[model samples]
Target: MSTVPKRFEILLVSEHVEDRGGASVEDSAVRSAVVEATGRHGASGYPIYEGHGIVADIDPETRTVEALLVDGRELDYGLTALVRTAARG
Candidate 1:
């Protein structure tokens, strides 16, 4: 028997500080977002990983729906609430 890979959602928030002028600019922007999100949300003690400015919250024991946040804006309240609740404990 084969098992399916678990899916999880990641919230991405980032800012462009300077015009690096190239793909490096994009890379830096993403890195900054990941660092910030991890610093803020990682405190929740949830399994958080930072890559390309994406902060992922994952629980192997639980299923998580996808959510995306760009520039610190939340597009879905339901997903936000779920994340908040999970973060609290």
Candidate 2:
């Protein structure tokens, strides 16, 4: 059986559109959405999303994300979807 990680990492790769002169608007919007989805302070020096038994640590400057499974014993479909959306953006 495949085991899900208690903690996982996500790398945010932004696509810079030359025509737009910088990062795509969609990318910016997605990042903002991710930030807005989170609550609480940054004890780890970065904003984190902790809810529904999941904790997401996001660092926009470094373009990295760390996802930790808290109360959940497994990564459910909803959690997987959330991560996929963030990673794709």
Candidate 2 versus truth, CA RMSD in Å, comes to 12.7
**Candidate 2 residue spans exceeding 4 A from truth:** 1-36, 72-89
| Candidate that would win on TM-score | 2
Q: What's the distance in Å from true for residue 34, model 2?
A: 8.5
TM-score of each: 0.27, 0.31
Q: Candidate 2 has which clashing residue pairs, if any?
A: none
Runs of candidate 1 with Cα error greater than 4 angstroms are 1-41, 65-89
Candidate 1: tens digits of C-alpha lDDT, residues 1-89: 63322323343223434455564432333323221224333344444533443445444345342333334454433223122122221
Against the reference, the lDDT scores of all candidates come to: 0.35, 0.41
Q: Give the range of the ten consecutive residues with the poorest summed lDDT in model 2.
A: 3-12
Superposed on all Cα atoms, the candidates' RMSDs to the truth, in angstroms, are 11.7, 12.7
